[model samples]
Target: RQIRSRFIDEVDSGVVRTETGATITQKADRFSLDESSSPKKSTSATSIEYDWETPVSGKTYKSASGSTIEYDLQDGDDPFQVGVIVEHAKFGPGKIISRTGLGMDAKVVVFFKSRGQKKLMLKAAPLQVIG
Candidate 1:
């Protein structure tokens, strides 16, 4: 109160500002922020979705974010049996230990070098024979 009357009121007579006990008001009807305003979020991966291409080995697809996401597709040739070595698109190298079912329902247990061991479907599991 004392500072406003002594300091502010002395130098505040140009635009004519009114000060009341409850309020000190100034008119700003000419204020505009349209030129400085913009969207909070810019064009991003989530806002502008990426249409991924069909994943295949030796082929690469770039995302909207500019990074190439590696899509390990499930593709392989069946030469599966016990003691057969194979390379998976995702799990790296593994050896076939056992199998179950046949053809489309075929599933095999494989011991992976990095992922320990897991069972994979023959028709769906992405594998390539290395050995």
Candidate 2:
């Protein structure tokens, strides 16, 4: 009777460790095409800009890097509501963990737990609150 959610799948990286704690690695088929490593070139030179503002909430968001973002519930919410999208200068995007007066904390927290992810700022960062 439960509807499975995609959010659960996004939680961890697919890599798994054995009981001995030795690393396990997987390989995918390798194929090379000329376009595989090619850079995408935009035909149009027009600039696209979006100024997001909420009249009721009085929230504003703007980013120049145009990085992809995602969000999760703010800990206590039920039915898994979406929270704020926390962007970083170097650590990329992550889910907001807790909220404070200044801003919210986010943890990238991948299964592999990259060094950068551990060092990623989990306390104060600019956030875009959404439903």
Candidate 3:
């Protein structure tokens, strides 16, 4: 006895083979080969803006009420504790709402009067305690 084989192409399916008394089926490639279907590039540059304000380190300024405010960067005091009133040149007066971590890796969150809330480093933050 002799066996014959042939290939069959279906619209919905992939390659099919028929050999004498047996049939085999395969799935077609689902990916596209055309370059026109590729993604397009934008003509304009993408713009990104940050909402957080950067405080100047070791800077001093006078408040609107005629009081001189200065940030002592070298002060070896843990003034960034919670519930402490701190003043910044850019964010004005703010209260330390929360403190996280410890030592050099510590961070504090301050709720300012006009600048909302800001997260700053504890040791290097530009903040001065208001008595």
Candidate 4:
């Protein structure tokens, strides 16, 4: 969707062309929600902070954006612990719901946003730790 929005922006600015070399007419690219249009946005007076606890790994994570994600991935031996987000070529993106084993023999049960929960081998699973 983000790529599609950028393509529309390019098309609106007359930077995109069709296969037949046809160019679109340029016009205003301003949106009602853009910073140039709506300069002031409402916000809460009190800052609210939250935390998430992983069901499988029994770990709690804090995210400023309200999403539980860990960034210190360089210090961990087991990267597939609960609350870790991972991306797979086939499974897309998901959170690790459960995991077992160790090293190359490890397995994780990830709950993919689009594909739902799936168990995959840590090795040869086309997985990348992305939390």
Worst lDDT run of 10 residues, candidate 4, spans 34-43
What residue runs in model 3 are displaced by over 4 Å at the alpha carbon? 1-77
Instruction: Give one digit per residue, the lDDT tens place, for model 2 in 1-131.
Output: 56644444443322432333333333343211233221322112254322222112223333334543343433343221234444444445544443322222233332111223332322333333232
TM-score of each: 0.40, 0.20, 0.40, 0.41
| Structural RMSD, model 3 | 22.8
Runs of candidate 4 with Cα error greater than 4 angstroms are: 1-76
Model 3 compared with the native: what TM-score?
A: 0.40
Ranking by TM-score: 4, 1, 3, 2
lDDT computed for candidate 4: 0.58
Instruction: Tell me how many clashing residue pairs each candidate has.
Output: 0, 0, 0, 0
Candidate 3 has its poorest 10 consecutive residues by lDDT at: 36-45
Candidate RMSDs in Å, in order, are: 22.7, 18.5, 22.8, 15.5
**For each candidate, what is the lDDT?**
0.58, 0.32, 0.58, 0.58
* lDDT digits (tens) for residues 1-131 of candidate 3: 43422332333222321222122333353322233321222111244322223323565655445565565444345567799999976799999999987443578899998989999874456677894
lDDT of 4 by residue, 7-42 (tens): 554544334434333333444664222233222322
Extract clashing residue pairs from model 4: none
